[model samples]
Target: MVKRQAQHIQVDLQRQQLRLLSGDACIASYAISSARNGAGESRGSECTPRGLHSIRLKIGDGLPENSVFIGRRPTGEIYTPALAAADPGRDWILTRILWLSGLEPGRNRGGSVDSLRRFIYIHGTPDSEPMGQAASHGCIRMRNRELIELFERVRVGTVVEIRERC
Candidate 1:
């Protein structure tokens, strides 16, 4: 299958949705989970930072769906219901990962608001986790299959904008 180049991604924090766009066309839309703490621009706040960002890196290109990731590196364990049940409180990062870095200075890039330092990413979560709601530690979370489809359609340096509303 020929893949389409993604132009940009808009993340609506208020609605808990992520949209992939190409010019005026809406390529795909997926339910996403943002931060439980709402939106802010400070490290350690556990909040999703607002403003423009880009996919600095794309990890798990060929990794299996539900492949576990920690610190952007695969841990060799695939996510399963039993594993999730064992660690109910664990912040699960699964499948593909789209690591994001802020572009706007002070507001989201530098000092205490540096998104890269905050380890912000758009990644996958367990199938049991609910989407279209704020439930993540900081990163945006999507379903494994949906995330894989998105990951294949985008590349590093793709623009991402996170906002409180549409």
Candidate 2:
């Protein structure tokens, strides 16, 4: 039996897209949101830390769409317009989540901009969240349906590269 290496994940801030690359070929691409203020290489800055990372945890597997999650745990309630309206201040995390950990030591790991310590993730969001736009508070956000598919395709230890557009 052949052992297959995990796919690589790439997030291009300029393109506002996340790509799943298998070897040298692109397998999937989806809209993504980075930091609102732009990228950085520090922890606790609420800025999207740059450099290489890995999937530290994959949360909310097998969950239905609109499934509510807080701190990465299912809340057991489906999202609705009414719920959103009632808690407009909520930073909604829905569908699926892929928690990321920084690989660089001084640049984006174990410091203020540490992606793992920063709780950065590529997660599902409400459709209302704008795509191809920089609107998140440092994490990457995708549509619920799209993220569900991505969550299923990727695995822990998948490499993630966040880079500026050239």
Instruction: Name the candidate that leads on TM-score.
Output: 1
Lowest summed lDDT over 10 consecutive residues: which window, candidate 2?
1-10
| C-alpha RMSD of each candidate structure in angstroms | 4.1, 3.3
Best by lDDT: 1
TM-score for candidate 2, residues paired by index? 0.92
lDDT of each: 0.92, 0.85
Error of model 2, residue 107, in angstroms? 1.2
Relative to the true structure, candidate 1 reaches a TM of: 0.95
* lDDT string, candidate 2, 1-166, tens digits: 2233557888899889999899868899898888887888665566787888989999988889989998889999999989999999676889988999988887768857678888899988888888998988889999998898888888898888899872
Error of 2 at 38 (Å): 0.7
lDDT of 1 by residue, 1-166 (tens): 2123448899999999999999758899999999999999899999999998989999999998999998899999999889888988999999988999998988889899999989999999999999999999999999999999999999898989899997
- TM for every model, in the order presented, reads 0.95, 0.92
Model 1 poorest 10 in a row by lDDT:
1-10
How many Å off is the CA of 164 in candidate 1?
Answer: 0.6
